[model samples]
Target: MLVLLPPSETKHPGGDRDPLDLAALTAPELTGVRTELVETLVKLAGDVPASRAALGVSEKQDDEIARNAALWTASTLPAIERYTGVLYDALDVRSLTRARRARADARLAVGSALFGLVAATDRIPAYRLSAGSALPGLPTLRAVWRPALSPVLAALPGLVVDLRSGSYAALAPVPGAVTVQVLSERPDGTRAVVSHFNKAHKGRLARLLATTTAEPDDVVGLRRLLRRAGLHVEHDGDTALTLVVPAV
Candidate 1:
């Protein structure tokens, strides 16, 4: 099964690897849209003020514009390695065993605003782009992405566990894919969707699934695998799982 994750907004600044190359990314079918976005960002980076405005950055965060300017020339790192946040910190790919790391590389994919979807080991550089960013002359990112992105995701073999959040998931719809939602149980026996800690929980779930040996092809089998990993899971529908956590 393939597990789809959301990309983090924060990233490491530099890397030792080579520069960006669209043709070499995992989903070649997205190269067209990727190239368009890359060029748009690079050009927008020419004017620092324009870049800052376009990316929703303030004066202090202008360095992000410089990063965009160097998109093609900046050193690269694996997509998983480049991202840094609560989610990535929880996933913690750095500490995994070699075999489990390899398994993660094979099973994980990140839903990207810039790259559309990239595999775990896909090399990428530091850049700033979010699902909500409206680039000059471009329509909503979801509008530009959906048509090209959906077909590629649909064509992937085997079951898919979609873990992408809001706008990232809006970029492409993964029909029939099993989705997992994290819910918090309150003292009054009430349950509500998790918020702040949600990403961390999803990250943990992704890490657990990535390192596991079991391959689940359906929602029931997926729940079985998650249960085997010690998660407290409950079914939501024919295609959804709700993992319960005590309220914080």
Candidate 2:
């Protein structure tokens, strides 16, 4: 899960391509990092010629070898998602535990990467929902929230940040009737406990979830409900459920 990238366009997308403005390390430390990076690239060159070519080593056979190596590296990593740019590559670490912070950070340093989207997003919603009823079976509703929501929740605006320890959530405008909270399921399912005073949509959503047997239709209905609740929905996978977030 260690995703490394050159400090180039690979890491910055539409943003700037230079090195990130992280806390400046001493020159010797920076040089050591560069040396390690070069060594990594050299190792990659033995199998990944493109990695070597990036370091100014050019040979047709080397290029072919590099291409295959790059493909292998990209595919072998446990990352659920990865992207290679002109100068750096990015990865998303998935299906991991909280103890894997270093691995997650390595993936994140490449670009606009995220980690623990599901757990972080679900925490607030679950807390909010528990205020009305004790969440006894909450931990039991698995398969719905935790394992599947990592990628979906990452795209959300405020879910990745710890708002409970700060006043960030307070700054959110309460547009009267629409309030969405994240909810966890027992069997590792991901869900949202949306509390809108508009009872009709809520009732509709409940009915849809209860009756819809097909996963696609269930996600479609969920997306429609979220839109009605003033949230934006993005559909990526047919089997993957839609992620709901406050609209910008």
Query: Where is model 1 more than 4 Å wrong at Cα?
Result: none
TM-score of 2: 0.19
Candidate 1 lDDT over 1-248, as tens digits, reads: 99999998899888975999999999798999999999999999998888777788889988888888899899999998889999889999999999999999899999999999999899999999999998999999999999999999888888899999988999999989999899999999899999999999998998998899998889999998888778889988889899999999
- Candidate 2 stretches greater than 4 Å from native: 1-17, 20-39, 46-225, 229-248
Q: Which digits, one per residue and each the tens of the lDDT, describe model 2 over residues 36-83?
A: 322343355464434433333346435433432332122122122222
**Looking at model 2, how many pairs of residues clash?**
25
- Model 2, position 169, has a per-residue lDDT of 19
Task: RMSD for all candidates, in order, please.
Answer: 1.0, 20.3
Instruction: Identify the leading candidate in terms of lDDT.
Output: 1
